[model samples]
Target chain A: MRGAVIYAPGDVRFENLDDPKIINPTDAIIRTVATCVCGSDLWPYRGAEPIGDPHPMGHEYVGVVEEVGSEVANVRPGQFVVGSFATSDNSCANCLNGWQSSCLHREFMSTCQADYVRIPNAHGTLVATDEHPDAELVPSLLAVSDVMGTGWYAAVAAEVKPGSTAVVVGDGAVGLCGVIAAKELGAERIITMSRHESRQKLAREFGATDIIAERGDAGVARVKDLTGGIGADSVLECVGTSEAMRQALHSARPGGNVGFVGVPHEVAIDGEELFFSHVGLRGGPAPVRRHLPDLIDRVLTGRINPGKVFDLTLPLDQVAEGYRAMDERRAVKALLKP
Target chain B: MRGAVIYAPGDVRFENLDDPKIINPTDAIIRTVATCVCGSDLWPYRGAEPIGDPHPMGHEYVGVVEEVGSEVANVRPGQFVVGSFATSDNSCANCLNGWQSSCLHREFMSTCQADYVRIPNAHGTLVATDEHPDAELVPSLLAVSDVMGTGWYAAVAAEVKPGSTAVVVGDGAVGLCGVIAAKELGAERIITMSRHESRQKLAREFGATDIIAERGDAGVARVKDLTGGIGADSVLECVGTSEAMRQALHSARPGGNVGFVGVPHEVAIDGEELFFSHVGLRGGPAPVRRHLPDLIDRVLTGRINPGKVFDLTLPLDQVAEGYRAMDERRAVKALLKP
Candidate 1:
């Protein structure tokens, strides 16, 4: 099997690796059908995040089951499936409460950018489609595994409602998908913060009613201006930076909500400031498994086309190029074929 | 008129003060019927907060309207009323959104310990009773102005639901009232953290089903054990210190909520830690005006008795003794008669 491995900053290589095997009775081995390089992947690729010891990368996939452990009954051999970046046992207390990302026996998926990948807690994590769909739907289905699912979580956390206003921070793939989610959730107005012309166009296509190119205080002023001197009813923070968090918090009206999905880095929130703002905040890794069935259905039903986020595609062997294109801002996201 | 003035830390003195007068068309002057020392007031008395110059203190009061400006119509002269510490124009956007504390024209009441106090935004901030209430209900009515209202807001922000488990951090008057709120909101179990025997007894009387005296890590462990290894469904943080905030956050299960009412002092929350916890956080000064009517009704109907939190009562002329007792922790709270 071949997979992408990170040796150091900007040093990704396509190398042959041993095929994964089931290590637990709850595990299953899936032959990767579709995979992708995510914006989060750039964290290590750009040296923003530490990379220690060479390891396989990737956490998004739509694959076909090759084999299953004895205990895995929900998904079996030959079934096309979608799974979340974070695997859960489905029946744990946290999972029952609809927070599968915090499942007691949770394991985050990595090493998915390969021909074959071993899935832990497969019986609970994998949701098999009734039948394999048309090839063109692969990208959207793969998106339902992470980015799209995450976007949905962001909207839910922000408590977006019909006839309410929503603001999306960050123009990355997740933020673009968030625009779609907010629209689908019945938000009357969708505002996205994006400076890149191409990304702004895509955001508008996804139902953004307004766009603010300004970044700090000026951006907040624009949001307040649009929101009648207050702020939006909901703000989806899709970037994991202190500046993005501050913008998201500032863009919400008192009693409004800010749902942050980006993995925060060195962000410290002042308790007094947050209290005075009177904004509700809830953020974490998206509980994708909890929304898998509904999102996959949305994709198959043609109600939403999140696949548009992938502006570039590459063969699995050229995964290095996929990372490079996204890192250099040449592609919003790159879909990889395995 | 007479009032309690704080000239320095531990130096509260009963002094003559100028009578308050209506300065705005929406203002009303109320003759003080009752006012009380608050847990927050201890901060200034203990030197935890700066005291620039001698100033009239106190923000909680139940009084009779002595005079009304030309624009005041909701309550007329001689009407008994209950008012919040924070006054607001009810027609503002934030007030209409149920966040009166964040109202556009909000003004915090700070001279209520005096014989007479001017009320700003009186048309929206004062809720007049149908008639003079029995003397027995005066204490409870006074509590509704702040402590009880704050506790109710905490329960609401935490989203307490029927059959859910709730935890109250802090054993002060607000925390005790929080226990009452959780019970009223239909929480099946209420856990209160308190080290003081008297406060523990009071908490139990206020519907606290369990009490954990442990602090810090041990306290959180106890909460987890009682909540089936996950924390409580909702946690009401009534103390403002960093330690209290951390305890409240850690005492809730993933996806649970923490409604913090304490005015935080120099507290900073790490964004990454909060994100991984999957907990929802919402905190602010309570929108007392929003809950005034309901709380007043509860008090008058004998459904709750938050006034029990006041263990020491003093004549208005002995205001200094009231402050001294509360500052020394000799009384849970002090009630004053003007």
Candidate 2:
């Protein structure tokens, strides 16, 4: 089997790899139909993150079930499915409470950028559609597997309400989809900050009522002006940078909510400012499992076509270019078909 | 008028001074019936906080309307009333949204800890009761002025569930009343940490189901054991110490809420822990204005007896001794008859 591997910092390769076999009773093998480059993929790709070894390179994908283990109950062979990036047994207390990402026996599928990926806890992780989706819906369904679900969680965690003003601080694919999620969740006004034309266009199309071309202060000021100086009722911090986090915090009203989905890297919360301002922070890794079912419904019903974020597509053999297009800012998102 | 003044650290004196005059058209003069020593009062008394020139002390009181300014409409002359510790016009957006402490023209009454207090925004700040209150309800009505209202806000901000376990991390008057608020809010199990006998008794009388004498980790462990290894569904942090804040955060179940009302001295939030654990934090100076009316009704109906927190009493002339007793931990809370 050929798979994408991260050999070291600033190194990525498509190499022949040994195929995976079922190791758990709830496991299943997926033949990858579509995979995509994630904004988080830039971490190790650009050497910002330390590479453990030549490792699995992708965490977002949608595929067909080629095989299922004996104990796998919900999913079956030869079915089209969407799954969360993280795998977990659905029966655990944490999973029952809608936090499958923190399930007692959670597993990460950060290497699913391969042709054939093995899924643990398959019955709980994968959601089967009524029928196989057309090639057009493939990218959108793949998004529900990770980034889309994450963005939706960000909106929900921020407690986006009907007719509320929402500020989204990142313009990556997930951030663009956060605008979509906020809109779908009934936010009356959505403001996204982005200097790039491609992302800004998609953000507007995804229901952003306004766009701020500035990065930090200007962006937050524009948001404040748009909201009549009250700031946003809900702010989503999709970028993990300290500046982005601060901008998100500063862009909210005194008693507003901040749903931060960006993976924090060297972030420090100012105790005094937070204590006095009364802004509540509620976020973490996208509880993708908790949101997958709703996202799948949106996709199936064509209520939200989030896969439009993938403006560029290529064959699995050209997965290297998928990363390059996103890294070089030529595309808002890139999808690869296996 | 005579008022309580702090000349310096460890120096409190009750003495006659010039009577307060209205500075705004919305102001009114009130004759104080009772004023109390708060847990926060000990900060300056113990010299934990710096002393400037002689400053007024005490933020909680219940009084009668002696005079009303031209624009005062809601409260009238000679009406028995209770007002929030922080006065606010109920008309502002922040106040209307239930965050009155942060109202644009809000004023604190700490400077009015004398025989007569000049309150601003009397129409929004004061709520008149049915004629004079019965004698037995004075202490309870006085509590609705500040501590009980703040504790109720803490419990609501913490999102206390109808039948879930909750942990209160401070043994002060507000913490004891948090036990009352938690129970009144329908928390089935209440665990209060207290080493002081008087506070423990008050907490139990207010419906604390269990008591943990240990301070930090041991206290958290005791709570966990009581809840069958699962942490409490809600945590009320009524102590401002970083240690108490950390304990409160650690004592909640994943996806739980922590309502912090203590004026934070120095506390830092760990972004990683908060994000990964999915815990929520929302609190500040309690939105006392938002809860005052309902609390007053609770007091009037005899559903709560918040005045039980004060075990010591004194006349206004001995305000110095009142501060000393609280600073020395000799009284959990002190009440003064003006």
Candidate 3:
């Protein structure tokens, strides 16, 4: 098997690696059908996330189960499935509360950007499709494993409602998917902040009613200006940076909601500002698993095409270039076929 | 007329002041029937909130309308009424969205511990009762002016629902009132954090099913211990300190909600912790006016006795003693008669 490894910042290699095998009674061995480079991957690739040693890459994938341990019951060999980036037992109180990412027996699914992967807690983490998906539907199905579900969580956390004006604070793949989620959730006016032409086009296609090229305070001002100086009713914070979080907070009306799904880095919120903002703030590592069932249904029924976010696809051997394309902003998302 | 002034920390003076007159077309003059010293007032009295000049004190009051500006319509002269500490026009987008504290035309009702006070935005701020209230009903109705309404907002914002386990983080007047609000909102289990015997007694009377004397991490740990290690379903944060906020966040189950009505001082939230907690945080100055009508009804109908939070009563001339009693923790609250 061949997998991608990051030895250092700007250092990625694709080389032969040992295949994964089910070690736990509840685990499943899956032969990767498709995987992708995540926007979060850029954090470690660019050295923004500390990396002391070479590490396995990728946490997002849709695959066919090749084998399952004795305790695996929900999924079987040869079944195609999509799972959340974070694996969970799914029976814990947190999981029962729809916060699977915080489940008691949670584990990170890493190195899935390879030929084979071992998924722990298979019965709880993997959502099996009725059958192997059509070749063209694979990418969209793969998105349900992470990005699409994350976007959907963002919309739901922001409480997007039938007539809400939602503002999305990023133009990355997740942000574009958020536009789709907000639209599906019945948001009437979707405003996306995007400075890139291609990304803006994708955002609009995904149901963004307006686009603002501005950043920082100006971007927030633009949102307020568009919403009659009261800010949007719901703001989806898809970027994790402090500035992005600030913008998201400032871009909401006094009693609006800011659903922040970005993996925050070096973000500090002033109590005074948040107190006065009167905006409901909720986010974290998205409980993507919570939205998987519905998103999978929507995808299989041809209701949404989130797969369009994967503008770049490469063979597993060229995973290095997949990382490069996304790191350089040449692709919104990179789909890798193993 | 007479009012209380804070010339400096620990310096409160009750002295003669000019009678208030309706200056704005939207203003109304009200003769104070009852005013109270708030937990928030201790901030200035303790020198936590700087006082640069001899500023008027008191912001919570229930009064009888003495005169109404020509444009005022919702309230009229001689009517017994209650208004939020923060007066709002109630016509702004924020107010319409249920965040009256952030209304475009918001004015803090200072000099309220006086014989008469001019209320701005009276038409939108004041809610008049059907008739003059009996002496016994006056205290409870006065609570609807601020503390009770704030507690109700905390419960509502925290999304306390039927069968939910709710936790109140402080045992001050507002926190005790939160227990009552949580019960009224259909919370099945109410846990209030209190170390003082008197406050704990009041907490129980207000519907606290359990009381935790621990503070900070221990309190949070106790809550998790009580809820099968998952924490409370909803947490009402009535103390504004960083420690209290942190505890409130930690005390809630993942995906739980925290309604914080504390006037924060020196509180800074770490974005990473909040994001990972998966706790919904919504707070600020309570939009008390939003809950006034319903709270007033409950008070007038004797459904709740939030006024019991005021353990001491003093004449307007003893306003300094009222502040001293609350600041010294000798009283949970102090009601001033003008």
Candidate 4:
């Protein structure tokens, strides 16, 4: 199978790789139908996160179960399934508490940017639909594997409620999806910080009621100015930068909540600001597995169109181009067909 | 009137001052029955926090309402009242949202160590008992003004649910009060990290199920070991240092909550630790006014005896000794009678 591998900074190559096999009885072999390049992938692609060795890429995927291990009772071959970036044994204490991402037996799923990928803890990680989704639904279903689930987690963690105002920091795919998530959660006003015209358009399409192009403290000031100087009831931090985190924290009113889902990069928070802000902060690698079933239902029923985030699509062989497009901001997200 | 004033580091003087009088329609002048030195006062007393000039001391007090402003309809003259250190109108958006400490019309009450103190927004800041309480209840009620309320906020913010395991970082009076608060909230096991024998004793009496005489990483390891290596379900951070904050965050299981109530000194938090730990952090100046009704009832009924933390008592004229005792760690807390 040909998979995308990152050998070094700016050195992504598509080459033949050994096919995946069921290594654990709880694992399932998934023949990838759709996978994508995520904003997080850019961290290593841009050499922001150290890339020590040649590593197989991609974690998001929606695929057909080509083979299932004997222990995988819930999902079987020929089933269309969506899985999160990380696999977990759903029975663990953390999983039971709805933090499947931090499950006791958790493993990151890599090499999904190939023809076939092995999924560990298949029974807990994979959420299969009643039937195969239509071809057009692949991109949207793929999103549930990570981005959409992450956005949903952000809204849920922030306690975005009906009739409340929500602020989303970041203009990427996850941030756009957060607007949709907040809207689905019944937030009356969704404010997204985005300076880009195209992203702003999509943000509005995803139910954003307002947009502030400014960044940093100025952006927080803009959010406060819009919300009667009290800040939003809930702030979703989709970017992990220190500035974005600060903006998110500052953009929430006293007693409000800030839900951040972005993977942090060299971020340091001023504890004094957090202490005096009187705002609640909760985030992490989202428990996407917990929300997969509901998000899949929303996608299948046409209730939400989060797939619109994929502005570009490529064949699996063109995975390098897909990475470039997203890295250079040419594409919000790039969907890859295998 | 005589009040305790901080003239310089290690210099506290009890001297004559002008008697407080009602200046606003919402103000009420109270003849303090009982007042106490707080752990936070040591910040200025030790010169950790700047003391530019001789400043009136004390913010915690239980007193008789000697005079009520015309607009102070709820608290009447001659009524025994318990008030938070911060006075709020209780009519602003923040007050309505249960964050009276950050109310639009908020004012910090100072000079309460004096014979007479004027309380602004008396109707909102002061919670009057059904009838004047016995002298024994004054100390407990005085605690509600700050320390006890702060501890209660920590437990509440940490979401100390029934049957949960709670770990409290810091064994000061506030942290000790957190044990009591956790017990009141039905936490099955309350673990407090403490090394001082006296503090540990007070902590156990306040309902601590276990005491880890460890600090920093070792303290977190102890908490994790107690929780089967998963960490406590809730953690209350009563210390404002970075080390205490880190211990609180690391001691909580993924998806657990940490409620911090200490006035942060100079703390910087690593964002990655917070992001990856998946711990919920919420805190600030506690909304003591919000919890006053419930806490007052608990104290009045003898259900909780938080005032036992006051190990020393002194006459108002010896306010200097009261501050000295607390500063020297000779007394956990000092209660002063006017």
Q: Of the pair 1 and 3, which is ahead by DockQ?
A: 1
Model 1: per-residue Cα lDDT over A1-338, one tens digit each: 99999999899898999999989999999999999998899999999999999999999999999999999999889999999999999999999999999999999998999999999999989999999988999999999999999999999999999999999999999999999999999999999999999999999999999999999999999999999998999999999999999999999999999999999999999999999999999999999999999999999999999999999999999999999999989999999998
- Candidate 1 vs candidate 3: which has greater lDDT? 1
lDDT of 2 by residue, B1-338 (tens): 89999988788888888898877889988898888888777877787888778888877877889988889988888888888888888888677777788777887778656899888888888888987898778888888787888889889889998997889999898998899999999999999998988788888989999999987788888887887565788999998888998899888876778888888876777777778877788877777777877888888888899988888889988888888888888888788988
For this target, which candidate reaches the highest lDDT against the unseen true structure?
Answer: 1
A200: Cα error in model 2, Å: 1.5
Instruction: Compose the digit string of candidate 2's lDDT tens values, residues A1-338.
Output: 88898887556788888898898889999999999888888877887878886787888888999999999989889999888888889778667777788777888887687899999989888988889998888888998887789899889888899989899999998898899999998999999988888788889999998899887788778888887776788999998878988899888876788998888777877666776677777887777888888888899889989899888988887878888877788877788888
Which residue window of length 10 is worst by lDDT in model 1 chain A? Answer: A108-117
Which portions of model 1 show Cα errors greater than 4 Å? none
Highest DockQ, which number?
1
lDDT of 3 by residue, A1-338 (tens): 88999898888899889888878999999999999999999998998999888888999999999999999999999899999899999999999998999999999888898999999989899989998989999999998888888898899899999999999999998999999999999999999999999999999999999999999998988998999899999999998999999999999999999999989999998987899899999998888788888899999999999999999999998999999999989898999998
Off by over 4 Å in 4: none
Question: Where does model 3 sit among the CAPRI classes?
Answer: high
lDDT of 2: 0.85
What TM-score does prediction 2 earn? 0.96
Off by over 4 Å in 2: none
* Candidate 4 chain A lowest-lDDT run of ten: A264-273
Sorted into a CAPRI-style docking class, model 1 comes out as high
Which portions of model 3 show Cα errors greater than 4 Å? none
What is candidate 4's DockQ?
0.83
lDDT string, candidate 3, B1-338, tens digits = 98998999999999888989989989999999999898999998999988887989889988999999999998888899999899999998888988899999898887798889999999999999999999998889888888998999999989999999999999999999999999999999999999999999999999999999999888888998899999999999999999999899999999999999998888888888989899999998889888988898898888899999999999889999998888888999999998
Instruction: State fnat for each of the candidate structures.
Output: 0.87, 0.51, 0.85, 0.84
The CA lDDT at B87 in model 3 is: 92
